[model samples]
Target chain A: MTKGTLYLIPVPLAEGAEHVSYTPFQLELIDHIKEYIVENEKTARKFLKAAGLKTPQQELRIHDYGKHVRDKVNYQELLAGALRGEDIGLMSEAGCPGVADPGAEVVFEAHKRGIKVVPLIGPSSILLALMASGFSGQNFSFIGYLPIDKGARSKKIKDLEQESQREKRTQLFIETPFRNNQLLSELLKSCKPQTRLCIACNLTAPDEYIRTQTIEKWRSETVDLHKKPCIFLLYAG
Target chain B: MTKGTLYLIPVPLAEGAEHVSYTPFQLELIDHIKEYIVENEKTARKFLKAAGLKTPQQELRIHDYGKHVRDKVNYQELLAGALRGEDIGLMSEAGCPGVADPGAEVVFEAHKRGIKVVPLIGPSSILLALMASGFSGQNFSFIGYLPIDKGARSKKIKDLEQESQREKRTQLFIETPFRNNQLLSELLKSCKPQTRLCIACNLTAPDEYIRTQTIEKWRSETVDLHKKPCIFLLYAG
Candidate 1:
C-alpha cells in the first residue's frame, strides 16, 4: 500500500469560540481526515468541531504530539498510521503547523521517510504580521523567540537590529504573552531612533492591532501589550 | 471619512480553468470588494469572475500597479477610494499579494499613511513549500531570487548553503520560469552529495509535486521543470 499523506493544517490565531477563521477548502480537507497529531487535544477537538468535521469525536483518533507531549512520545508511532496508508493531519495550537512549533520534527521525519506532505492555507501570525509590517518581504528572517535573560536578550536584539540594517531585511521575533510589552520597551531603548518597528497584536482577533512606526514614534506612544500574543518586526534599512 | 481597510488577497497558482483554488470566505470577501489593486488586471478579473465576484466587469475598479507599472503610475491615487472609507483589495497574478511580488510597495505605503491592512487566510506558496520541506522551521531565511549571472548565481547558492549549514536554517529561493531547469541542474552540480534539496512544483495545482531527497539521490532522477513556477529549498546542516 502507498504511504499515507500527511497534511499540515493551520488553526485560528484567536481563542474565541465563534471565530470562523478557516477557508472552505481547508475545512473540506479537515472534514475528510480521520487521524490527527495535535499540540493540544482539547483545542484540536474544538477547532475540528468549528471546522465542522463530519466524523464524530468517538470515531476520530487523535494523538498528542505537541510541545507538551515531547520527550515522552516516540514520534515514529505518530506517523506509523501514515506509513500504513492512513492519511494523518498535524495541527498546532494556533497558526500553521511545523512553524516555530514542535511539528517541524514530524515533518522532517516524514520527509526522511519519503511520505507525501501537504500544507493547507490558514492564518499565520508571523507571515500576516510581516505582510502588514510593510518591510522587505523579498528578504527576511524569522528568528523565533529571543533569549530571555536581560543581558543576552538585549545583545541578541542589538545583533538582530544590526543585521537588519546591514542586510536591509526584516527581522521578526515573538515574545511570551506577558513579556510583549517588555520586549517592545527593550526594542525602543536599544534600537536607533530611526529604525522602523512594527507591532502586530492579537493578529486575527476582533481587537487586532497592527501598526508600524519608527522607534522614536513607538517610544512616545502609550502602549500596553500585556498578556497578548504579539509579533515584533524591525527594519533599519 | 474613516480610512478604508486594505485586504491582501491570494490568487490561484495555475492557469487551469477548472481549479477552484479559493475558500468560501475568500470568495465572499472578493465579492464585497469593489476596488482592487492587481498585478495583472486581465488575470485578476478572470480570477474574480471565477471566484463569483458579484460586481459587474465595468463597475469593478482595477488599477494595475505591478512592477511593470511602477514608474508609469502613481499609487497614491489608487488608494484614494480606500482613504475615503472604501475597502480596497490587493491581488497578485498568483499566490498571496505583497509576498515575492510588487504589491509590497502598496502595502508599505499604506502603513506610512496609517491604513488598516487585513491579510485574509489564503494560499502562500512560500509557506506551503517550507512546511513540506521538513527543514529548519524555527530559523529560516527567504532569499527571493538568485542573481541571474552564472558566476554570481552559483556563488549566491554556495553562500546560502554555507549559511544554512552554519545556522541550521532552511534557505529558500526561486528562479524565473524558463530558468527552472537551469537552476536545478546548477543545484545538483554544486551542492554536497548529502545536502538535502526539496523542489515544490505546481503548488496547489492538481499536478502538484513536492519531493525532498539528498543531492546524491536527486542526481539519479530526471527533472524537467521548464516554464513551471517552482520553489527550491536546500539545507546542508
Candidate 2:
C-alpha cells in the first residue's frame, strides 16, 4: 500500500531560452515537494541555485541515478519515502526527463512501486520539431538520431523515405551537432525530389529556424542551417 | 516586424486533473502572462472559462472549449491577433497542443510568417507512452493516429510494422477514445507474432496502464482495454 508520486520534469530545450514542452501547472507548489532526484548531483545543485528552488529545501544526495541499470536500491528508498507521503521531483540533464534522457528507469521503478507519475511539459525538441516541420502530423515517427556510419546512415534514410511513402507516415530524425550538415547533404542526395523536408534548428533560441521545403528546393538552396543544433523531419509524399 | 512569439500551451491530460507533462517552472511565467493578455478579460475567466476547466475558484463551463472551437468566426479572429504578436498561448482540449492537434496549423503558419514558435514542455501522452513502452527510446517514431477505413488502416499498420522491424525503429500511434479496444484487437491481428507491442492506456490517469507484450500474447490473452484513449507502440526488435 505505497503511493509515491514522481514528477517527470522537462528541462530547457535550447541553451538560453526555455523550450515549450514541460508545463506542469502544479510545479509552482515547490513547497509541496520535499525531495528531488536528479541525474547529476552538480546539476541538481545548479538548478536549485539557478531558480532558488526549495521545499524544506534540504539537499539530499542519495546516490547516482546511474548506480544501477534499474537503480532498485535508491529507487526503493525514494519510493519508500514517497509512500510515506513525500513529494518528489525527478530530473535529467536536458530535454524531457524520461524521453531521450535518464528518467526512464526511475519512472519504471516508481510505477512498479505503485507511485503516481506526473509528467510536466516544459521543453522537448522532438515534439516541437515535428510540429514545426510541415510534414504529415496525422502520422509520424521519431528515430532519435541517425547512425554514424555513412553507408548505413544513407540506407536508413532510404528506408525511412520508403516507409513514409508506403505508409503515409512522416519520418523524423535527429543528428549530432557536428554531423548536421553532412546529414543534410545525404538527405538531398538520397531523398527523392518530391519528399518534404523540414529543418528545425536552434529551437526556442533567438536564432530559431523552422524551415520547411521540398528536397528539390533544399538541394538548390543556400540556407544558414549551421546556425545551431537542429531536428530533421522528412516526409515522402 | 511584430516579432510575435508562439506559445505551445499544454491543456489537461484528463478531465479534472492537470496534465503532468507540463513542468511547473514554465507555468510560473504563464501566471505573469495572464496579467498582460487579459487586459480586458481575466485569464482565470478566459482560460478556465474557454477550456471549461473547473476549480475551487469558479463554476466551470467545460463545454466552453467545444463552444469556443465551434464559434469559427470568433476563433479565427483570435488567431489573427495571435499572429499579430499578441503572444497567444496555443492550448488544446488536453495534452500537448501542436503535436497531431489542429493547433499545429498556427505553429506552421507562424514559421511561414517569420514569427517565433516557442514550445514549452508539459504533459504529452506521446513522449510519456514512448518512455513507458520499454522500447528503445533513442530511435522511435510517433505516428499520431490510424485511418478509419479498415483496409487502408490495416495496410498502414502493416507498412509501419515492416519498417519498424527492418529499421529497428519503434512505431508509435494513438487512437480516439472509443476506438481504442478495436484498434488494439486490430493490432494483434495485423502485427507479426515476433513484433513487440506496447499499450499505454489512460496515461497519467488513476487507471493508467502500460503493458508490453508480444502480438501473440496480446491476441491470446483477455485484455480489458476499454473506455480510455491509448497510445500503441510497435518495435522492430
Q: How many collisions per candidate? A: 0, 50
Q: Local distance difference test, per candidate?
A: 0.84, 0.66
Which stretches of candidate 1 lie above 4 Å from their native place? A16-20, B16-21
Query: In model 1, which residue pairs have backbone atoms overlapping below 3 Å?
Result: none
Q: lDDT tens string, model 1, A1-237?
A: 899999998888887622336666666677788999998899899888877788889899999886666877876798998999998999988888877776877887888887898877777887888778878888889988899999999999999999998888899989888888888889988999999998999987889899888999888999999998899999987
> What is candidate 1's DockQ?
0.63
| Stretches > 4 Å off in candidate 2 | A15-37, A56-58, A66-89, A109-116, A219-227, B1-8, B18-92, B103-110, B113-115, B146-168, B185-198, B203-225
Worst 10 residues of 2 chain A by lDDT: A18-27
Interface RMSD of 2: 3.8
lDDT of 1 by residue, B1-237 (tens): 689999988787766522335656676787788899988888888888777778798998889876777877765797888888899998887777777776777887888887899876667788888888888788888889899999998898899889889988889899888989999999988899999999999887878888888999999999899998899999998
| CA shift of B99, model 1, Å | 0.9
**Winning model by DockQ:** 1
DockQ scores of all models, one per candidate: 0.63, 0.32
Look at candidate 1 and tell me the lDDT of residue B65.
Answer: 76
